[model samples]
Target: MRTIKPVQMRSPVLTVRRVDTYHAITVVAPGVAERFRAGQFVAVAVGGDTSSMLARRAFFIHDVKPDYGGTVEFVFEVRGRGTSWLSECRSRDLLDVTGPLGRPFPLPRDPVNCVLVGDGHGASPLFPLAHTLRRRGCRVDFVLGAAGAQRVFGALAARRVGETATFATRDGSLGLRGRVTDALPQVIEDARADVVYGVGPLPVLRTVTAIAAKYGVPAQVAVEERMACGIGLCMTCVLPVVGDDGVTRMLRSCVDGPVFRGEQVRFDDVGTIPFDALGAPGWKARPDDSASTEIGQ
Candidate 1:
């Protein structure tokens, strides 16, 4: 019979420092913040109860700070029952948390015109990415997309890390008055992006992948998959992948990666393939939003 191993864990009532509606959720989890990485995630049990949750909800690490005991950060749109619960908690309430899970985004080998594209909560991880890129002397250009201006990244904050940045909104309520993908041509053309990294809706990633392919720019994506165990034991969230040898394979997005190259992922084959065939429970479509789209595999 399948079983769950006991994991020694800590719970804390994280005060909600700030809420960037479309951008992120800044939490004051002092000791846990600095430990996470860009693209990595944490599984949280609201109100410290996992009984009804079945599986802890996974959220993107987004960003963390070493100070304030290193508060961990997550940016997500309110789309499900778990998060709606999260929204109800008071500023200083603790949560049952486990993680620093999932593979992190890749750091550039050398400074290239790295383009960071993310929309809404997907934009969370770009902070560290942009920071790391700037530290390495790589020119960074960030393009953020969201429903409206209220749903955007920390603008002045991002400008502090990246050299140049742009914004686009679906309702034309913000920067470009269009989708992030719509501003790609302009962002790419203006910044001369040579390496591209993205996190957002699958459709957004798909569009980014195509643009990168057309431009011959090396790009990577942080894929969001439903995860139950948060460990490799559950074959619930396997994503089709190609190995270094060019052979097709299956990889667990929760463990092996949340980060994958634009080329390695079988994007076209995702929703089409049967789940049982891919070492997962069943084909559960995790549509667009990377936030609420949980892969309870």
Candidate 2:
């Protein structure tokens, strides 16, 4: 896997289209598009130049087109003020964007059977990834889920991109009347998937990881976190992850990864640093504080 240095630029909004229950914003960003990799994302400066929102909102690139040099598309739901302001932007409006950040999904060296799982707007990144996987002679199957039909992001595109696309909605407004995980085990068995990839809420990734492990299939997952800087400088998005040496360390999601091996991530310890993690406070006292001595003690 390769990571390219990102560029910060003010790109004009090409279009803002509403798809399903999400908003898809396309920006004219040649630099970002030129370096764009599947599973990578862009950080957008919302609320305009004079606005008070200092934290940049990160969104995964849904598509990149070669129109007007290059254009990048990202999807989001208007949950708060940042996204609410973004939803109001129109064609010809300019947006400050920096991308294609974070470690992208690593492709296999040889063609393999791959199952891609996504929930809600998290399905955006998987579209580009699915296309790339197919080009490498891999069999791609999709398991997309959401709360309801309007919440499912890309049913039509998933159908066109993968060999088979299965959908589940809680409200039974889509294919199967359940969540993606409920339908995943059967899909894995039927497809004989060699590897699994997922992008969604933390809970979803955690469940997907467990299911993939049960089937003895390798999994790579992209995590969604509230990135304050989107550039690793803030240190606000650290999570405990096991290194190859078997030591758990706090790693930054913005730089270390938005993508990681499913089994290595400490999913249950995401929001808080684990006490046993390397360099964590009181790390030396975990097993036996009675025997452990401090510098002055």
Candidate 3:
């Protein structure tokens, strides 16, 4: 859980720029910047005050700058009306933002060999995480992937930040011609990684977890879930996760995670609650015709 409480404020836009295939927005959010941890996210209210769009768009905190009091930057690809509106935002625009939300990536207590994997804009958070790891004496390596070269975020930065940077593109437009996961196993092996960290869509995370398991290394993954609210109040982002007690519970991604032990997540059961999950219907009893009839009566 986060020790710093998130604050909602009308933050002033500091910069808006196009970064290859993504848009990067920096806002003057001192509160968020000061308390931010890599892998945490922010939710921005779009469509101004009167527009009908109700849900706040969630974005990972890409980076933070200490200048001008403090500022937080986030990157995104404009996929719909809400994001399109965000792209048009200019300097000095006041956007309602709430963040440094979600549980952040937990840092290791001792320096170790680490491999970080990212996909598309999901690579945003890993850059900052790599920096932190290096400062803690961890050797950082990167495996970044996207559909094409232009879509792969932070390749040049990865080269500079990591001990070695490996890239994969499905179209053969970059490093290796395959999914990022295709490059993951080799990177982990060569780096002699003690731990693997990943950020991407659910399927990618699932594959990353499997690869780490094969190498007998622990995996920490940040998941991409459609969050209706960036707070725990909304149950929209719940996913099945096995706790230390071996109980499968539907945990909220916003608060309980966006970052979780990769092995503990029931990735295949993400969209549906597992029948045996705690509190799930029929977890204790098998539903049958007699039970249904009794309930009806």
Candidate 4:
């Protein structure tokens, strides 16, 4: 397979259809939009510069209108330079982007009550998963967690798509002011879930996964990591992957995943994206600007 190169492509200015501060972006990029999946991501060349990596940032595809030639929308948060750039971008400006990379959410093999937990930019990937599950007649409760009112997004949009929505803000601005896990007691009490969908900070994912496991519920997490060669060669996006044998392997998050089972990941190594092999510099980690909603995908 040819590694997707930044050099040989014409960046498109994805006209903003709409924008949600700290929540989502609706853009019209029909060419790359149609091919994306819920857990899969697209690498965006910030400011359309191919030379210096502001790195090709990855976004979890939130809404994919296939009829619009795959024109899609993205919902995420503003964390650093790249994302900030994404926020400041004008409607008609062109930017380079690539692929529906990595594996998608595991469509549950057995039907069970599904609870979707969204935190920070982690919320982006679950939109499609929630919608698809609801269509299949599964009962889904979507809980969004944020530091304050500013971090939550698309509640009305989520409801329209068929998920029963709730919010847990740390500041108590609108909903519960505790951690996502803190809301679990009441949430799970109302409904016994078979599966839990989570996207958010490492600590949150760890806590969510632990809670689900304690209750015998299967949990899946949408993982995001820093990327460079979106196809995996750069190894800039290495995250722990669990194989059938139960051993955690460091897989290139770019190609292998931006999605992993909650139980399978090693959250202790969350942000330690190896700049060198075991922190050495001879094989230094490239200066990476490319990032995702979470950095362990």
* Candidate 1 residue-wise lDDT at 41: 81
Q: Estimate each model's TM-score.
A: 0.82, 0.94, 0.95, 0.80
Q: How many pairs of residues collide in model 2?
A: 0
Q: Which segments of model 4 are wrong by more than 4 Å?
A: 1-11, 17-20, 269-297
Could you give candidate 1's per-residue lDDT for residues 227-253 as a string of tens digits? Answer: 777777887887777555443457777
**Winner of 1 and 2 under TM-score:** 2
lDDT rank order: 3, 2, 1, 4
Candidate 2, position 61, lDDT: 96
The residue pairs that clash in candidate 4, if any, are: 13-93, 13-94, 34-70, 223-297, 224-294, 224-297, 275-285
In order, what lDDT does every prediction score?
A: 0.71, 0.91, 0.92, 0.67
**Per-residue CA lDDT of candidate 4, range 151-194, in tens?**
67656665666446778888898578876678875676577788
RMSD of each: 7.6, 4.8, 5.6, 7.3
lDDT of 3 at 131: 92
What global local distance difference test value does model 3 have? 0.92
Show pairs that collide, candidate 3.
none
> CA lDDT of 73 in candidate 2?
98
What TM-score does candidate 3 reach? 0.95
The regions of model 1 sitting more than 4 angstroms off are 1-8, 17-34, 274-297
